[model samples]
Target: MKTEYDVIVVGAGSAGCAVAYRVARESNLEVLLLEAGSADKNMMMHVPMGFAFLLKPHKNNWSYQTELEPYLNNRVIDLPRGKVLGGCSSINGMVYIRGQKEDFDRWAAEGNKGWAYADVLPYFMRSQHNEAGADAYQGTGGPLWVSEIVDEFPIHQAFIDAAVQAGHSFNAQVNGATQAGVSWFPRTIKKGKRYSSAQAFLGAGRALSNLTVLTHAQVTQVQIEQGVAVAVQAEVKGQSILFSARQEIVLSGGAINTPQLLELSGVGQQARLRALGIQVHKDLPGVGENLQDHWNSYIKQKTQGVKTYYSEGRGLALLRNIARYLLGKKGFLGDSAATIGVFYKALPQASSPDAQIHFAPAASEYDAQGNLRPIDAITISACQLRPSSRGSVHINSVAADAKPSIRLNYLATELDQQVAVAAFKKARKILLQPALQGMLQAELAPGADVQTGEQILEYIKSTGEPVHHLAGTCKMGSDAMAVVDECLRVRGIQRLRIADASIMPSLVSGNTHAACVMIAEKCADFILRSSLIELVSPTRPFGR
Candidate 1:
């Protein structure tokens, strides 16, 4: 393997893969992409429904448990991050949501220049090949394949009709001009296979002569000299190796790992670094602060006569579905976990849709051994789209392999609690609509007895789970606590940039994979533009 490259991208996940692919494909610069996990050769990594089996402790998953959350009954919630070549995009539900446009506009409002919906739309368009065809909002002819669910069941239609009867509008495209109302979710699946970032970006650029990729190579630290990032120290097969970067080093580790790496590299709070017995290189207090994630709550209902995945996932039915998928790339096995989605305003005072719900004609629970077992039920899971609560992630150990401390601090604020209760109530209301009332037998979770707002809040505190859309650890802005500037360059450090969810100043209103890709597209543009300018003026300093 080469020791040096023009650009080095750490963590070959969603953003990292895109950054490396764009730099290698668009320019003549040499690029190296590193991933801590093994290759994406696992069968489960490609099968859409295989994510169910991967939810537990698996080789492709970094199933880190959070520290006991103070607000959620001191419960330790599971935080599943992808450890494979595509990261969470490979193991995710495959649902493709670009979030509300106001989400990006808010970022631009927060002093993050060039991040508004208008400014970032081009990047979003440049990253995906939406099978639905290109419109003013959607794009085509990109690497990532964005497809609509091919097969829709009776239960899906029933749920959508019920939601509309409950006063929600029926939207054909949630990721289009407006993000409000019920719709069938679009997915990152193409021809029955999970189209992950690794497959979309890395696979397309793998044959490029200047591009190199190494899996199972964990980056331990970024070597800094006089505030300039020079190289990265990585552990490959129990051996330490130093890889130099002639131009720039891009950290694309997601929210948790990015902040943890920054802290480990001595770019965090000086006091915290000293307390952990680590020498400080740059005192950036916001390296691991302003953490954010969607706190998800769900309502499950037992189905009376409806056929759900619970029954179809067993015995001869399971074999039939498998055969169907294998033969024609069509069946439950080829579908995303959630086939329908609802975006609505839970609070009347909110400007846009403040809550989002995902509907599936199936339900499951963890057994005593923590294995996910299917149940005979349907589920409506809800989460506040833009939460006000903020938590943090920081390293608790000096070792690179040690898991970092994750505190979601979910429902810490009164507004968050109110939104959670309202979203839950809204979900229940939709389930009770006449269109779905004949299908649902009874409410299984929180029960019919729990009707009051206080009871709903209590139920949420006990059962809320992290949606795993973690972001904002290394926030990008011009504020005091911002870790990166508007250009994605780390503050007080040169030749270093972050191109993942960690750079989000505020979490988007929906699934984060699309936004992470957009961030990477923009990051690559910045780097490539700088390189072009430097080429024109040979005497100019690099990445100025």
Candidate 2:
């Protein structure tokens, strides 16, 4: 059976929620949002410290893995994306950050018109209702709630001070005029609770009559007819169904699924689709080519006397913390896991923002699941800002339920390696600072004897893995290789648009949630204006 709506938003992620919420609240458009996972009913999803718990297979996430990176000895790295109603933001570290200004300015210079920092600032302001109150760049009363550090710890403060002593600036806000500094990170938490996209957008619109949210509804393909998106084919409870988009279709399925869905619906390379036994609809060659993300080489340190979260003796404390969290939203469950974030240029001649540092207070035992294991661990992760390397994602076969092939051509550039090396040395400096020296017992990951640049380069090559900030599969630009235009409309297609991280021409500096929602806010305006123009002229296809 088929159901129709003015707009069908796929993925219900940070961007998808923003798109549906804005369309429902601002415009008279009826919207339908479909999520691949179940409703945000998991208790762990609401507790900030519960991010690690939700990373289990067949839980609140689609636990995907990359096809082995040769540099890391062909180890398949895990990639956990949110499958719940709010998407990854629901399971993210919850740190609120907007990247450096140059990141956006570069997008405008790269044929993406009006996407620079200045042009998009208003939308960013429009979506935030800062708990720290309004600032020059922040909003006073927007849907997405952002607040300064509501809960602070001693270790977190020392990390911030150590960064300052190591020549980094101490700015209260990272989302300000300058981004190259260490600061107490602002988060999407309101009243000491996790404020996910589900809370900000979906929660606000749940009572609205014009909006319908379906969880466990995985969209397998976009039903395109004569080069236009008409409906979406979804699977719910092992049953297949169709939902039509009356006005337009917005693909917010994120970096991986967005491109895969487009490719499955025959909207990518004709040669590739033909090989997969699928008929071609449009030949948009840039479907899933510009994959980008942050990668970090962890530096582990052993600590003494002062009990750390990752120490062997702290297991019971952690259990007590978990119990405290379940009983009342308190303890480690309130932590974002990431206590500190820093953005900086690796070298003076660096063309744009080059590196970012993530400070995890826990030890090497703190795995990708964001859970703490026994050991005193503090991670100093550095990622390349604008790595020259590029990758692609495509369907493994014609079957709609099959997972896509993700090839991340990591370390394909010498510059990417150089920045990573530089960022590591800098990270070492911060850890070795006198303020932190008392706590650290030894450097375990990369020892003090590893001095040469070549040695550090090898260490990075051998140890680095992605920070999981994937983007740019359906990049927005006007070039031949560009998949979507500046306004986010697909090339050679009508009434279809991509409103997610996939449309990012270059990955933003920090975590992508804030920027993704900002993109949706701007796109909502574009879509609304296009609809208004159509009503007046009753002609024109809403494009360049």
Tens digit of per-residue lDDT, candidate 1, span 290-386? 9899988989999987778887889999999889989998888888978999999999999999999988899989898777789999989999988
Candidate 2 lDDT over 1-544, as tens digits, reads 3388888989899999988887776666778989888888887777776676765565777787778776556767778899888899888889888888988998999877899899888888888898777777888678899876644346677788888898888877788888878877788877657899989998888777778888888888888889888999998889988999887889999999999999888899989999988879899899989998788787888766554556422657767876776677666557675767877778768865578777766664556656545466667777777777788888879887788888777877877777878888887888878778777788888888887888988887776767778899999998878999988999998889999999998888888999999999887777777774223222211220
Task: Please give the distance, in angstroms, between residue 302's alpha carbon in candidate 1 and its true position after superposition.
Answer: 1.1
Off by over 4 Å in 2: 311-328, 366-374, 532-544
RMSD to truth, every model: 2.9, 3.6
State every prediction's TM-score relative to the real structure.
Answer: 0.97, 0.93
What is the number of backbone collisions in each predicted candidate, taken in the order shown? 0, 4
Give the TM-score (vs. native) of candidate 2: 0.93
Best-matching candidate per lDDT: 1
With candidate 2 superimposed using the best TM-score fit, by how many Å does residue 452's alpha carbon deviate from the native?
A: 2.7
lDDT of every model, 2 decimals: 0.89, 0.80
For model 2, give the RMSD to the true fold.
3.6
In model 1, the Cα lDDT at residue 329 comes to: 88
